[model samples]
Target: MRNPSSTGAGRLLRATGHSWRGLVDTWRSEAAFRQELLLGAPLLVLVFALDLAPLSRALLLATLGFVLVVELLNTAIEAVVDRVGADWHALSGKAKDAGSAAVTVSLLVHVAVWICVL
Candidate 1:
């Protein structure tokens, strides 16, 4: 029989693979994901150009990471909503709106952090 640890490692690898595929799917389907990538890639390059303090650089990195993560979650929420139905039910609308709010909050945090740091 295979070792239990090996089996567990296989499961973990499979799960990671699924998540990576989902990220790519999200990127392809979601306009917001593309926008975030466009905005964030340049900002990340600018971050390196700025010659920032170590602490400031760390904060900027954190904010950029937050934007990426939140965008992913928003895309996931939207995908689930679309999968559920293209209908305009109230709960479905709320779920999409909440996902939008999450993106907004993340953006606000990014703005606040960068403004404070720079």
Candidate 2:
């Protein structure tokens, strides 16, 4: 028979893989991901057109990545809120609003970096 410890480890690996795939699916379905990709693609092109130094180009890309990352977290929060219930609840509203605020701040930061760098 297979070792019990190895079997348990395999189950854990599968569970982790499944959870990651679910997150990826959510990212694909979310409109926020589409918006970010649209904006980021053009921003990346502009950065390239500017012919920035290697460090500056990297910083610009990193800032855009931060915006996308925050968007994914916001999507996750909204998904959880909806998953919990459709009915209005103060705490649920606050959680989602807070997540949106994070996205806003990330975008603002990206803008600030672009202004300073370019």
Candidate 3:
């Protein structure tokens, strides 16, 4: 969706506001997101403390970021699906499932990367 503001700075400011609202809404409503944060935040701190090669450390960080990004996208997908209607539809289920699979795949890769790095 196009931002209402015409100027670049205005648009950026508006977008940031929208993003902040999204994060707030998601955090308040989504249990899985909160759970992920509980797990990921400490792992993030642990990553910074560990002595590791730069490349490995970066890979670990990237994987954690990837999982959260995918989770956000999945949440967006689920929200859109619900907004469409309450009725059960095959296509909607497929879209939700696909988004969930993306998160699962990201998590698997995250675990693998951490294992390899350790």
Instruction: Name the candidate that leads on lDDT.
Output: 3
Model 3 ranges off by over 4 Å: 1-4
For 34-95, candidate 1 gives per-residue lDDT tens digits of 88888999889988999899889889988989988998888878878989998789998998
Write model 2 residue lDDT over 37-58, tens digit each, in one string: 8878989899889978999999
Q: Candidate 3 lDDT (Cα, whole model)?
A: 0.91
Off by over 4 Å in 1: 1-8
TM-score of each: 0.85, 0.77, 0.91
Worst 10 residues of 2 by lDDT: 2-11
- Give the Cα error of residue 46 in candidate 3, in Å: 0.7
lDDT of 2: 0.88
- Cα error, candidate 3, residue 38 (Å): 1.0
Sorted by TM-score, highest first, which candidate order results?
Answer: 3, 1, 2
